[model samples]
Target chain A: MTENKAFCSRCGVEVEPHKATCPLCGTSIQQTEEEEPTSYVKKYPDEPAVKTEKTGRTAKQKRIFIWEVVSVTLLIPLLITLFVDLIVNKTVTWSLYPISSLILAWFLISTPLLFPNILPLLYIGETLPPAIFLLVIDKIEDGQINWFLDVGLPIEAVVAVIAAIVIIGSIKIKNKGMNIAAFILFGAGLICLGIDFIVLKHTRGTFGVSWSLYVLTSTAVIGGFLLYLHYRLMKNTKLQRKLQI
Target chain B: MNSSNFPTKKTDEESNQNHIQKAPKKDWFRLDNAATVFSFVTSTRIPCMFRFYANLKKPINVAILQQALENIIDRFPYYKVNLRNGLFWSYWETNPGMPVVIEETKYPCQKMPIRKKGIFPFRVRAYYNRISVEFHHSITDGTGALIFLKSLVGEYLTLIGVVVNDWQDVFRPNQEPHYEEYEDAFKKNYQKNLPGPPRVSKAFHLPFKLEPKGVFHLTIGIMPIKQILNKSKELDVTLTEYLVAVYLEALQDILFSLPLRKQKRLLKPIRLQVPVNLRRFFSSKTMRNFSLYVTPYIDPRLGHFSFDEILKQVYHYMRVEVSDRYISQQIARNVRGELHPLIRLTPLFIKRLFGKIIYNGQGEFLYSGVITNLGKVSLPEPLNKEVENIQFLSAQSPVTKTGCAVNSYGEKLYINFGRIIKEAHVEKLFFRKLVKDGIKVRIETN
Candidate 1:
């Protein structure tokens, strides 16, 4: 006599090779189309057990492709704009213009739209350490006029980049809504700005209306008005009249 | 005190329900479920000057009126018992021999200068205009209340000098159509087209309390019997349908402070809750609450629907509801969950709780308004002439509200409304419209 068949893992029913799901309970039993004969025979009546490797591979490929495409699309434009002035015009050495343009675009426009929250980090990226580096390089490099970027900009630049990573990486723990990443990014940027202000307090003043506050107020007012209009229009519609519960 | 003698009518409604060895269903006030019984005794002290309505030119003598009230008390033996379970009922005790209790107290009816709450259900009321009624929501509704009002009016008419012979012709007690039986029986008896029960969809409650400028009692008389019956034919609907359609249309125009076409659509699905009598559900008068209801929904978007269109909808729904097939199906469906033994074994408290879930949760008996057509009034043969009209106005807003009470003796229809929402010009506007449509409506105030 033939040996009794083993139950499918997902549906708890006897496996059949041709069927996609158990006839009794309708649970999907297969995750892949093909398997080795030995693995299939050993597991059940000639039917392979479900596999999860396919799903993992596809997900990894998708994420890598998206990250690559988005980074190139974003960085390429700003890099070209900055270097267009430096390398092409040959006025600034080594075309440091490309890096500075990316930083500015990321801080003001792109970061706000992509994730309005941590946008403050851009100012910190552009300031603070560069100011200190200018003093240090001036003393060390025989007080050369061009030594400012070599010292000051790098420290400010490093802190801004690290802060963005810290905020965006922390958001990985939360499986939330789409705009959540943006909110976290904006928050991190804001904190970096605060740190930069503390560092540069002696030289510069953080003015009256902060960038974050201005953006939030305008957005809220527009959204509120739109919602109010929708409410008034829908209040007396036929759909509302038909509602029983 | 125990040998029972009560009139009985054997109908399919009384079929298969007597599992308890037929020991004449216990007196309503002495039922097995006694925990829920409540009692209120109201002592009325009045100069009885309102007796003018009771006895016009040759007023009913005070001694005679008292005797008449006692006679009614004696005839309805169920009215004599205290509030008890199973056989739930309520009544006022009338006695000419006992001393009368008359004291004046202020009442809060919207506007009517001053009017005393009557001695019975009118006085010791447990009803608030909004939210919930104190009694079990399952027991009685606006429709059943309509019947009760008509009966009270009939009783009042008898107290006067007039006799009530034609009351039966004018008012016929209709048992709730037991739809459990086959269609053959229904077709044979209830020929009118009827609709299914009403379902309330949207209820817009305004926080503003009514502030009436003035209130007056005006009597609306039905056109000549021939005229109304003829118009009813031309409209191809029942007299009730035509009247409601007219009023609903009028309310659409009047309820709003401003006039706008879109505003009319806001009042769509004007639901009307009509109560059906369940007297024949079982063969026992000992039951206090024996009525069920259905609602008919009308779309107000028809703007100004023709009298015929409104009448057809109303008449058809009423017919369908009262039809044998519809009634039986409803009964079978309502009874489907309960097996015989489970119904009997279920404790009263549990039953009441279940009732709350069913009535408040599932039942949509009250429509935008309720029109309780007490059908025909049945009174003793002699009291016809002394009575001009009988009007029963259900609560208007808060509490158990909606629907106008209508009672017709012949050519006269008594229309009653709460003082809060009643517009004075409507009485005239209503009559003018009716007369224009060849249906004469007369109004009188005394």
Candidate 2:
């Protein structure tokens, strides 16, 4: 079978037999007498005309739906406790604890679901909830936040700062490998020292050190060894040559 | 399924069976140097896949094609593996399942769901009169894919009662695969301590709006091979150099057509990434990604360049860059990067996170566009008569927006442009220039 062809009068290039206009310049093609449109087969098949049905919920929609369900589920217990406390004691006295805990739970769960790609928001979600929960408990028990300020917030701040350093350092490092472990180890050592300092100050009303020194020494040694291996031993050209694939 | 009906001799079949049973199965393979980047950067937008197809004179028979695929798959044992994730890097594990032949999709080079369990890195697809193989770049490059396609078409033709006597480059189904065919040639030829090629400045990108995800536009321009070759001969340059010069001129036209302020703002070098097949330089038979690219650029800031000037630049640039010494420097750089202790020790997850940044910074950011030519394709005697033409389609890149693949079969030279952008300015300009230069072009789009 012979294939029929058409050329664009303006462009002087052959167009597909089925096309009425040139694909390049959109100029109309003058069909010849011998050209039969239906005689030629398309080189590639056309896209299916029937659009496939959208049957399932999108990922974002599903995440939002789950968050709504969790919110409602958490809300039910909070509402029940609030009503019971009001009915028995004529105020939101005992319900505050459950209410605060439920709010903290919702914040933690929704943080990942809503701001999953936003790292700073997720970090805030992780660090802020416990501090708020502890402050609320401190106020509820003693009508002040002295312990929350001296021990709770300080310890949380130390952990958050160290965790941030490790995470950001890991991302920023040019060649990320054993050095990440070293960063984590060093961060852990700092956290131990921070915890010891805060607890000692809060308990004994003086600044001093304790068991954390041993922990700090051990972590520093390991962390230093990892650093040495990563920077010194691994970077050696001779070693790399020996290990080359 | 009849043994006597097949091409493999009875003795060869017995030996192949024995080899399979006696050989220790390599359950896993490390990603080659070129493939390591693809493994990390490949996603739905950038599938990192390419397609090579052959158009036969007759409609394809699905059952016979399936049999042909099964018969020939063992000869390409490396391609039969599936992608698996390891601690330090991604690997290819032996996949025991057979790749089923499926009907061709409306689109070409769609993302292979390789991360899914049991999914092979390459797929065989058949359409009305065409049979295609889409391979993830991790599995092979264009040369390897072309070899695989030729073999498959040969096998298919043979099953359909055509005698294929010329199996010079074609891997027959009955033949045993050589160990060298599966070796990583990049690692094998790497020379340490050599300086890498000079760093390239960021090149100009097409100012076209990206199409939606999963949308790839293909425009193919077909012309007579003799006409283009004669034109290239008149210009005193090879066909590749002629085509690249035309491509560069097209980009220059687009850049100058824009508003002056916009042109100044986008006044970067127009560098085309032309991939060089390294097997020609180094005597290696490995069927993996053993190719590097030479970026022939024209700086718009210098001055307006005529077509002749661009051709001169591309011709000389290609001459100097497509040499063994220059290519070895590239291989050295790539192998060195892969062998660095920190890079080797870095966990796969962390590498994946940084891979996109690295790819953007060091990969596509350095080139304006990509044009890969597979040159002329020739099949053996009787099989050649049954085949009409062959087409190569490169994968769509979100950054570069357009890539061109060129190959010739018989008398027809097929230039396919794969784009992920809404505009077809590059395709239009490139083809119109060819038509204007007295070479007839037939256009088809998908």
Candidate 3:
């Protein structure tokens, strides 16, 4: 059996059958007559000439398809409600609010899903639907863009701008803390104060913050406490381990 | 049954039994000059991969293939090494165990993360009778890769009770690996006095738009080598030179067809890179990357070149550039840079930055596209009788939207055109031209 075995000319190691070159040195393998013979037959039938075409949807297209399915699912319930409201009231009375709000809600939810990669654009883009919904409601029942222009647009613009800033800042910084949550809380509080001032000024001759002061005080205390906890967590390794799964 | 569906336990135990005690100890080796450029540029989307598939006579037995893979792991230890990031250059550390064999997926050559912890640089996938190995370019050149594939196939056939002739010529299990197989041949053959190869100003690019999803498509056109050889004899050039001439002629048509203004802006000389295996030139037996490329250029500005004219020019250029001294100068330029004191001292991050710059400014831009011919693959009589066909496909990158690779087995020459672009016009043109010259081509795509 040992005499029947052949070896590689370059490496002096026994070579396997059917290899054209030595696997170790890559030299052209030398052939010899010494080998055991046995019966080996082809058992499986030949494969037909075939090619698999790439017809499946891309990842981006798949996401868009899911969005369409969700949108259609939501739209069906709103349509049923609209018919019920018409049968009861016999006029476009209560359905107007639900119809307008549902459309606004769908737009806000889908816009983020539609352009998920552009974070800043999503923050700013979500503001349009709410303002448009308000204007549409004002036109259907009464005929005024006054509420939209004075309060709706301004409030939406301020929030969208602040949200965009926070998102863009978070992406730029590597070491994120709980500062982002605190920043958003302070921004929302400031927006609320501005909203109170706007309402007071519109109804009366003077502008004064009434409801927003209490809201601001609460948010400030909570945000300050969160900042303290975040710093403590960063320093305490044992506690960090205990908090995580 | 689907290819991924296999009997798991039997295969696992057989492979574990064969390879557990004999796994080679850890070994480390430096990357050659040609391989040094690959690590910095590798990414998930654009992995440096070259793959080949063999259509067997019978359906693949995964249990036997896995066991065969484990049996032969000790023979090709250089390929079994994991890439390690060094301070100055990336290196390879011998992985302690055998690489796992997996089923083929929808995508081919999806990134192999050798740089990441505990990852291998090559993949072996089986789909029925088709077994494909996609290797990172850093480990081996085409010749070395072909040898590895042949050895794997040889082992697979033997495990299934196939009578393989000339058994000693192929890689056998339990053979101690040769130390010289890991030597950096480029460093051994480098000369200090040689001059750098001439600089290329600009190379013409294909004007087609890239595919939307960036999916690479491979089209295999199999034809009888006799017809190609006859044509080459008529043209009085080698088969590789004749094929490259046809490729250049196709690019020439695209160049001249553009409108005058667009032509002036985009029309540059077409430089076709042909990779020459250095094992033939230098006497080293190392299997790691030992190859350099020769760029044969055609200046469209000079005048319209007929097919015959292009053939003559390619033949002449290949002859001159493939010589011993000319090839040495090409290797010298790379070895000289590696030997520089400041270059050796630079950190890995800085070296990566320089690698990127060099790849963009000097590496790929010097040529329009690459066409690698592995020449011919030969197996012993009995084993070769059971095989039907073999196909090779080159990897496509951002800079190169398409590339060509050729390998011949038995009577058929498989010309694989790999492209990332949306249009298959160049591929269509290439086949149509071959048919026009009286060669029948059988086309398959994925």
Candidate 4:
């Protein structure tokens, strides 16, 4: 049999015959013709046999399982509460609010976790459940469809619009932090003003912007400052230093 | 769900609109047969990837390498696309952003960072004196990726004032991305009118344990070219056939020693999947996936097979399978399945389910292991002088558990064996077998 090539003792692997130093770690090594092989031959170490568990779940699947377990666990309590309340009251009573709110919470949490890609659709999908749940709670409590169609629906619509604006803006402008801030502040200001108008119409019988003026003034000022900062950062060297962090 | 408010899937159109500032019509494209399998089979657990690396004489400049990577991206727009969901087939759409480049890590060919959708399907990493490019097999085959890596290095050398000429041998930067480069070569050359090749049954597999973190073991053996060539000549077979025969011998040795019942289950056939680059047989220069495989095997049920017998068998099968008619028939087999009327009508989710099943149940079971020979990698003179060695490593298959890739440069041939199992039984036996043949073997590990 021919001679085995020289190996780097530091690396515990063979190196090129011409190498004076290890290619991986620049350490000096010397090999002679009669050197014994330092590496293993027929057998590998028995301590670390590769893990052979075939049916182990992946990280994402594990996360999904945990979420499923949490949902099921929460469902049991909700079901117990509903059964107890229905049996005692003989009608849908105080349990209606908690059940509707729990379902609304589930939709909000699960939509972002599950269907994260299509945000616009998710924003719309998330809005309908909460608005409908509010209507359900309202009908059970007062036996009337009064404030839901007027105030709750409008507020949800505005919130959905603001969510869409933020999602689209963040997706479009990758590095424009100030632009995203300004867009969110501006959308939030408009949404606040719209909500105030809807509430004022319900309370005072007319569309008059009451508490919204203060929100509009503060949000407009902050939004304007953010826009100015964004433009100034685009033109100055100081922005680069801040961005490097 | 309200259909009016929810936007239609406009990925291609939206990408074009942002780049050109005009609303363009949707430009969805279908996944080719080779690419289709990868789309559904890829998870964080089992990503299909292969990596190639070049060792330089001096340390690599990260800045210049990153610049080279960015410059080369415009030329490979076929690889610059993002995956999208389609009605019956997953597709690719234009990626209007640059591909990511980073420094290499301790892990060489790990599962590609494909968890995030819309990320590029390839990555360029540099560390120490080595520059490695790993590609998702969905994006391109070895030949195509090798061309890209060579061109990127060539561009880097030129930028650093190395006296390099004739990038004409490889794909040069600033060349317009051609439609032909991305064309599904299998589809274009498919003989729909001809009959398909004979179907394959389940093949043998190794009952090896795998690493928990999905980590793989890579052992690269460097041997002199002349020693192997002389042995091949003496045996009257090609170098690949000689190597395949040796690999077969190692498997047979393991097979006969196993308990009788276990042997009966695992000893159906010892098949080696030799990926045949189609560029040699066909005249197409497309950089997309265009390679096919021929499984050359030995049925243990046919009694004992000596090394020489295995060599002759591999030599004959390679000769028959590498021919144009047989390769075309194989292509017809794959194309016919895709062109099936019922398959065409299947929904995307259902198709993905079938694709996953086919990948795990069919793709993995049909081959015991894979051996891919990149032939030889040569650079222009000054650059070649700067580069010391080249290496290629493929991810270990979940089923096969090990794979072998070969790359040669100068007088050195590098055989990289990647396996998920901790024990290096096959590699140790193969190298020992080489040493027994009077060939000097130098081994490296990662």
DockQ of every candidate: 0.01, 0.17, 0.01, 0.06
Tens digits of lDDT, candidate 3, B88-204:
567787777678788776556656776876677788888878888888988887766766777788899988888754553355664554556677999999999889877778788
lDDT of 2 by residue, B1-446 (tens): 00111132234555476465332445667789889889888877789999988889899999999999999998888898988776577778789999998877777888788778899999899988999999999888888888889889989998999975446667777677666667899999999979988787899988888776667888899999999999999999999999999999999999999999999999999999998888777887677888888888899899999998999999999888889999899999888888865566556776675666678788998888899888887777878899888788989787789989998888999999999887888988999899999999998987
Best by the lDDT measure: 2
lDDT of 2 at B394: 84
lDDT of 1 by residue, B129-216 (tens): 1101112211232323333333434454555534544443122233221222111112223323344333456532221233222222
| Rank order (by lDDT, best first) | 2, 4, 3, 1
Task: Write one digit per residue (lDDT tens) for candidate 4, span B40-108.
Answer: 777545678888788887778988888887888777777777776645556676678887668665555
Better of 1 and 4 by DockQ: 4
**Counting only residues 3 or more apart in sequence or on different chains, how many pairs clash (N, Cα, C under 3 Å) in candidate 2?**
0
Q: Looking at model 4, give its docking quality level.
A: incorrect
* 10 residues in a row with least lDDT, candidate 1 chain B: B43-52
Order the candidates by TM-score, highest first.
2, 4, 3, 1
TM-score of 4: 0.64
Instruction: Between candidates 3 and 4, name the one with more favorable DockQ.
Output: 4
Q: Give the count of colliding residue pairs in each prediction.
A: 59, 0, 2, 0
- Candidate 4 global Cα RMSD: 14.1
All candidates' lDDT scores? 0.38, 0.83, 0.72, 0.72
lDDT of 3 at B359: 79
True contacts kept of each: 0.00, 0.30, 0.00, 0.12
Off by over 4 Å in 2: A34-36, A48-245, B1-24
Q: Where is the poorest 10-residue window by lDDT in model 4 chain B?
A: B1-10
